[model samples]
Target: MTRQRVSLRQELPLLVWLVIVWGALWQDFSPGNLLFGALIAVVVARLLYLPPVELGGRFNVLRAIPFALGFLAKVVAASFQVLFLAVVRGPRVISAVVAVPLRSRSDLLVTATGHVISLIPGSVVVEVDRSTSTLYIHGINVRDADDADKLRKEVRETEAGLIRIMGTKAELSALNQEVGA
Candidate 1:
């Protein structure tokens, strides 16, 4: 398949993120190291024939700040919950694999939601149906139908939060409409 040529402007975010990750991995953010990382980032981006990742061309830092904080809080809470479950429930903890259908069809939104859900200690995304934008999340301590429904709600809520943070305008509008309804 012929790949559409992506402009440097369109690809800048990926290149910049790659450089930051490279610097972080090496634990060296010195100018020389960052420059080297940037050089490698550009080379990898250019050499790889991956499809372009389309961004929304906008990001809401205000929205992201709260989302990030909430995510951190969830991580902490889930970590303790997992530890408690392991100690208390031991071998009898109930777990379920639940399918969550997300509102956004964008691959980025789906992937981001999956990561957020998996980052929480008690749950991990086992599979993704990209065509349907559905996530199969395996969650520990989900003992009943109510728990499964709750998980699905949380997954969709995460996607909604992401849509608020960096989704395309149309997606944002759709989310607003859904909430409004």
Candidate 2:
């Protein structure tokens, strides 16, 4: 029988998260509970083993700090702003799908941008054109083309940070230059 080796990179962190979640869910540690937790851990590890993009593997935790903090602040502020618009202004307020041309070449950055947009209350990522590197985002409160453009810039910055965290500084710099041009 060939021995299956588990890499610490792939297994340890997953195991920790599993254990913490398991502990929270079950106050009593019976045999069945232990087995269930182990099964859950195995399933999670299996899923982690097959990530859609491998870019997150190189994620620099330090570079991610600013993005995480900024994302939280933006989300909180946007939530209230969106709520106010929704409550005060009826559905007559403008909404449109704007195409944002992505600067970063990495699929991870593109995906991250889509996710961040979706997380915000007023916007949703409808589609991403991988070949053209453009994001189609539906904005509920977009007033004009300028608003759409501003949203695109914000998304680009957030995604650029993700690229930097994933160790693509050179690629991101080139992308930034292209955007500037």
Candidate 3:
């Protein structure tokens, strides 16, 4: 079997991110330190069996800004909601592992959506069914079918927002058609 050729453009983001993380870890911003970090990053990138991350080739900053703000708001509200549930329901808080079937089959989008949902309080991704592009999320205060439906809807909406921001044109078109229909 032959290895797939990876373009420099595809690898650059990972290398740059590695350098930034190295610098952050070392708490150094000096030019010499950064140069050294860059060296290490390049060496690591070459030595590691890294998988290629497919990019959308276009990013919509305008779409990203609103999504970010909305995510922050959800974080805040979920925090308060979790706090309320903890105080009122305590150990008796109703929780369920709700299955959320996502539209996008892209690993990047599905993972991003799972992360965004898990970052907010009261829910966490318990398992991911990559074969089905599904996320099984354990949610707090999900007492019935309605609550579970809301959780699934919330997770899918997050995926839609991510798709709008940087999804491939095909994915965006499909999403648009789905919404229009």
What TM-score would each prediction reach against the true structure? 0.89, 0.71, 0.90
Clashing pairs for model 2 are none
Residue 97, candidate 1: Cα error in Å is: 1.7
Deviating ranges (above 4 Å) for candidate 3: none
- For residue 147, give model 1's deviation from the true position in Å: 1.4
Candidate 2: tens digits of C-alpha lDDT, residues 1-181: 4445667665666676776679678875677876788788888777655442434456688877877988898899888988888799977788889888876666867877788878865788888899988999888888898888888777777667767777365775675686689
Model 1 misplaced stretches (Cα beyond 4 Å): 22-33
Candidate 3 CA-lDDT value: 0.89
CA shift of 114, model 1, Å:
0.4
Enumerate residue pairs that collide in model 3.
none
In model 3, where is the ten-residue run with the lowest total lDDT? 49-58
Candidate 1 lDDT score at position 160? 88
